[model samples]
Target: MKITFLTVGKTEDAYLKEGIEKYVKRLKHYTKLELVELNELKNTKALTPEQQKAKEAEMILKKITPLDHVVLMDEKGTEYSSTRFAAYINKREISSSATLIFIIGGPYGFDSSVYQRANDKISLSRMTFSHQMVRLFFVEQLYRAYTIMKGEPYHHE
Candidate 1:
């Protein structure tokens, strides 16, 4: 099974890129992984929150194939421990009919349409985090999950 991370903006920090790359490489040991970036919508000076989401949502929807199992990286979604997260990924890989996708939306969060299309939602943490930082955290957690699943020493009980 393949896993894809679809995000709405560019990652400006090289530090974030470095951190994400480290874990992303590790994630490949478990499954094929890809990070798809959509161009951020421009000229948001006059747009309302909903309007911004609408424009961003259109671009997001276009990138998503019908067969993809969309999961949002949401703050208010279900939270899991490292072991449970490993199980979740394993479950999807075993049972999913298509690629599993996790999306991180823009500053205003995901649009209503994006929410409608998602099959599940996962929260990396209860505390709110910057979207750029979330990329690093998400990839690290994925690596940690694999370590847990493999009974490796990287993860501690």
Candidate 2:
């Protein structure tokens, strides 16, 4: 199964982009992986938080397919150890579904509709992080998860 990370807006930082690209390359060796950027809302400053989430939710939902197992990367999501995460992906691969879509929502987070559309929610850490930084963190975690699945030394117990 393919893994797709759908994030709002673009990664503008050159350094962050470089790091994200590096992990993307590593993950490609283990799984079909890609990062998808949802267009940032226009006139975002004028929109209220709810309005922003609603607009962003619309774009996010439009990008998802019916077959995709939508997973949201949310702060309040269930936290997992590396091994556990590896097992989760292994289950999906063995289960033979379509792409596993993980979304990093907008700065204000998600709307009710986006939450309703999600099949699962995952947390990289209990601590909060910038939405842009989560891109690299998530990709690195994906690579690490695959390595653990392969019995590689990249992940430790």
Candidate 3:
């Protein structure tokens, strides 16, 4: 199975970009992983929150294929312990040959259509983090999840 991390816009902070790249490189030891960035909407000051999300959703949906199991990193979504998350990924890996697409939406979050298309939603924490920060956090957790699954020492219970 392929694991793809799709996020909106660029990670402009050099520090954050470094951290995200580190995890992305580490993850390659486990599975087929890819990171995709969707361009940020231009002149968003003119658009309403709803309009911004709609435009973002159009780009997001266009990248997803029917064979993908879309998962969104959402604040209101279910939170999981590291072990449980590892198990969840294991289950999905065994169950489907589809691509596992995980998305980190923009500042305003996702559109209703994005929600509708998602196969599942997961929350990294109850507190909010900047959308850019979430990309690093998510990739780290994904690496941790693999370690947990393989009985590796990378993650501690």
Task: List model 1 lDDT by residue over 1-157, tens digit each.
Answer: 7888999998889999998988888888877899998888888989999999999999889988899999999998999999999999888877964888899999999999999999999999999999999999998988898888788899988
TM-score for each predicted model, relative to the true structure: 0.96, 0.97, 0.98
For model 3, residues 1-157, the per-residue Cα lDDT tens digits are: 9998999998999999999989989989999999999999999999999999999999999999988999999999989998999999999899875799999998899999999999999999999999989898899999999999899999876
Poorest 10 consecutive residues of model 2 by lDDT? Answer: 38-47
Model 3 spans > 4 angstroms off: none
Error of 3 at 33 (Å): 0.8
Give Cα distance to truth, residue 7, candidate 2, Å: 0.6
lDDT of each: 0.90, 0.91, 0.93
TM-score of candidate 3 against the unseen true structure: 0.98
lDDT of 2 by residue, 1-157 (tens): 9888899999999999999999998887888987789888888888899999999999999989899999999989999988899899999999887899999999999999999999999999999999989999888888899999899998877
- What RMSD does each model have against the real structure? 1.0, 0.9, 0.8
Q: Please count the clashing residue pairs in each candidate, in the order shown.
A: 0, 0, 0
* Clash list (residue pairs), candidate 2: none
